[model samples]
Target: MKKTPSIIAAALVLGAAPAFAGSATPAAPEPVIEQAAPVPFSSPDWTGFYGGAQLGYANIDTSAGGDDDGFIGGLTAGYDFDLGQWVVGGGLDYDFADISIAGGAADLESVFRAKLRGGYKIGNGLLYATGGYALADTNTLGSDDGYFIGAGYEYLINQSFSVGGEVLYHEFDNYNSSGVDVDATTVQVRGTFRF
Candidate 1:
């Protein structure tokens, strides 16, 4: 009976040892995989108020009978609205220049102009048209003032920046001591920055 008990005890210990060893071994640490984060999906918005300056050339054809061309510089301010692929806006601008009629013999006059513009955005560029009024100081010849119209296109080089070119026409009725009526045309290349 003692031998039988020893055999039973030995068999029990051998069977239990394998189970205990297996439990202690720690189950191969379940595969520790990790997932990556998702990226954001959205575009930037562009609608606001902007202001800038412009420098350009102006050519005037006088109906009273003289022609003049010179450089012009000015400041501009406006508000913009972005609607899908198109953007619309209105702006006011002013420019000053020293211009003369006839020849270098004639005295220099200061010319001033104010304008309003409307534009449509096409791709990275904008197509625009503008109209306004102009005023200038004439020698004893008198002063000239009139309405003007223009059209231009601008390409956006980056956010808050653009460059453009335009052509404009102006008409002055019965201007100055010369008693001559004048019509003028101007073309200019301009650049602007937005805020």
Candidate 2:
């Protein structure tokens, strides 16, 4: 009977030894997997007020006379509306033109214009067209009222600045007090500060 009890105790100790040993050297826990964060989508934003300077070439043709070409420099200001991939805006500009009559001492003085602009967004640049009214001064003929049409392309250099180029045509009938017609074309490079 005592031998039987000793054999049972030994069996119990042998079984319990493995269980205690297993507790001391447990299986390694499963590795914690981590998922990467999703990447953010980004695009340029173009909604604000802007002002700039323009410098370019001007060619003026008068119906009663000949053609004259000279330098044009100006300042511009506008506000833009950004609608998805399209942009709409309105602006005003004043220019100092130095064109003179082909064979006379008279010259074109300055120009003031009001325009509406529309553009399509491509990457970080905008391709646009503008049309509006223009008033021009002459050294001999006096002040003339006209209309203008233009097109341009502008690219954002950063968050606060942009650069662009434009070409515009201006037409006037019965210039000043004279019964003469006038047409002028200008090509300009522009730099702008955005807000």
Which candidate should be chosen as best, given lDDT against the real structure?
A: 2
Error of 2 at 63 (Å): 0.8
Residue 77 lDDT (model 2): 94
- Model 2 TM-score, all chains together: 0.79
lDDT of 2: 0.89
lDDT of 1 by residue, 1-195 (tens): 779999999999998997877776567778878887887542223367777777777666655456778787777677777775556666666676677765542433555666666667676777878888777565646566877888989777777887788888877777754656666676767777776
Location of the lowest summed lDDT over 10 successive residues in candidate 2: 97-106
Candidate 2's error at 152, in angstroms?
Answer: 0.3
Candidate 2, residues 3-27: lDDT per residue as tens digits? Answer: 9999999999998997877776668
Best by TM-score: 2
Which residue pairs collide in model 2, if any?
Answer: none
TM-score of 1: 0.64
Pairs of residues at least 3 apart in sequence or in different chains that clash in candidate 1: 141-177
